[model samples]
Target chain A: GQQVMQIPQYQHVQEGEDFTTYCNSSTTLSNIQWYKQRPGGHPVFLIQLVKSGEVKKQKRLTFQFGEAKKNSSLHITATQTTDVGTYFCASVTSGTYKYIFGTGTRLKVLA
Target chain B: SAVISQKPSRDICQRGTSLTIQCQVDSQVTMMFWYRQQPGQSLTLIATANQGSEATYESGFVIDKFPISRPNLTFSTLTVSNMSPEDSSIYLCSVYGSTPVGNEQFFGPGTRLTVL
Candidate 1:
């Protein structure tokens, strides 16, 4: 079985501060996807990283995949209150559509 | 991208009872996944349902407790049988597909279940 674990189970940051969450997997992954779930809402697709050692950016957020493809990280700079949510990293099982979600990191940004 | 809707957005049931949650997707998808999110916790996959085949339950989850029915490509149902207080959690349904950006997953609003 594959297991995905995320660091910083919970984080609270002051507005304008930066935040980062790490996702580590027990085995290498073909692709990894990131999701954000707001309070009382469902998880929404954020981005996906496929190639090893890949880096992608969206506005103030940046995503990076490890060269081994066994880990990933999401960093948000100048975070705002609106950036508060639980971040989850997911990867599909080999030869299957089933996705295993990481433990998730809950972010709380203060005003 | 797909539009996913779940029925009974929230419910409160007594112990020993059963609740059936329905998921409807606007487009046909090959695989549908059910997940459980406990309070202040992360998402845990309960099972994966595929059309024309039996659903596959994840580790620690049993078919007898969480029965799933995938009658068609765009519809599925998950029934939590003999519910208990420990079963109180948010049940989410998601579908996987390709989008303009790349392959991704779309989740439903989720059913908030509270077992008394």
Candidate 2:
């Protein structure tokens, strides 16, 4: 069985603050993906990391993949009200196209 | 990237009733999937919907409870049969677009089911 876990199940922050969510997998993964779901919205793909020690960024958001490919992180700088949502991390395990998602980190930003 | 649409944005059903959710993709896709998002929880995969063949379900899921039909490459349906209160959740349809860049899955708006 494959399992993906995330930490800081919930976080409350003020505008202009920073936030980070960590994702870990029980087994090695072929690729890792990040998604964000706003209140009452569908899960939207944010980014994907494949190679070990990989780093990618979009605007103020940064994503990193662990050297072992079993962990990943998503960091947001100067968070805004628009950043309020549940961030989920998913890992594609070996021999399957399916993805196992973490419990997710819910971010709450106060203006 | 592809645009996805689902029918019956939300529904209220009595216990033991069933609901069939429809999923349509703008572009043809190879693999389609069904997932459940429980209240305040992560998404759990139900099964992979394949065209012209029976769906391959995941552990803890069965075709008896969640029957799926993929009649074409761009269309699919997931029927939650004889659902209970535990089945009251958001059922989503998703797919990975055919592309050479990478595998990126796009999700539908989801059908919110509330069983009483």
Candidate 3:
């Protein structure tokens, strides 16, 4: 079975500090997607990386996919209280479109 | 991404009882899925609901306990039969295949189930 391992299960940071979460898969993935879930809310899709060694950014958030397509990272610069939530990374297996989600990294931003 | 709506946003049920959660998508989709999110835990996939076919459950889930119904392309139901305290969790229904890019699942608000 394929598995995705997320580092730093929980993180707490000051309002202006930086935070980073990593996702590594047991095998190469077809694509990787990132999501953010607010406390007591469902996950919302943020971005997807399909190409190897690709990078995408939104506002102060940067997303990157490893050259092997088996690892990914999300980094936020100068976090805010509104950034508080759990971040998840999902990737499809070699043959299926069904996405397998990581354990998730819960981020807490204090003002 | 697809827009999904799940019914019975929250419920309280007794042990041994059964709970059926409904998921309706705004538009037709190829695949639908059910998930469980325990308090402060990550999303765990329960099954994949396919239109006009039986659902495929994950490793830890079984069809006898969690039966799924996909009567149409836009509507699906997940019945949690014979519940227990461990069944208490937020049940979410999601859909994929509205966008042209790779399949990215979009979830509904979720049905919060509490079994006592």
lDDT winner between candidates 1 and 3: 1
Runs in model 2 deviating more than 4 A are B98-101
Q: What is the TM-score of chain A in candidate 1?
A: 0.98
RMSD of each: 1.0, 1.1, 1.2
- lDDT (10s digit) by residue, model 2, range A26-111: 78888899999999999999988889999999999999999999899999999999999999998775798888789999999999
Candidate 3, residues A7-107, lDDT tens digits: the string is 99999999999999999997998889999999989999888999999999999999999999999999999999999999999988668767888999999
Q: What is the lDDT of candidate 2?
A: 0.93
lDDT of 2 by residue, B1-116 (tens): 89999988999999888999999999988899999999999999999998888999999999999999999999999999998999999999999864453687899999999999
Fnat, 2 decimals, each candidate: 0.90, 0.72, 0.72
lDDT per residue as tens, model 1, B1-116: 89999999999999999999999999999999999999988889999999999999988999999999999999999999999999999999999878877889899999999999
Q: Candidate 2 versus the native: TM-score?
A: 0.97
Report the lDDT of model 3 for residue B86. Answer: 95
- Give the C-alpha miss distance for residue A58 in model 2, angstroms: 0.6
Best by lDDT: 1
Q: Recovered native contacts in candidate 2, as a fraction?
A: 0.72
Lowest lDDT 10-residue stretch of candidate 2 chain A: A91-100
Clash pairs detected, candidate 1: none
Cα-based lDDT at residue B93, candidate 1: 97
Error of 3 at A84 (Å): 0.5
lDDT per residue (tens digit) for residues B14-102 in model 3: 99999999999999887888999998888898999999878999899999999999999899999999999999999999987646545
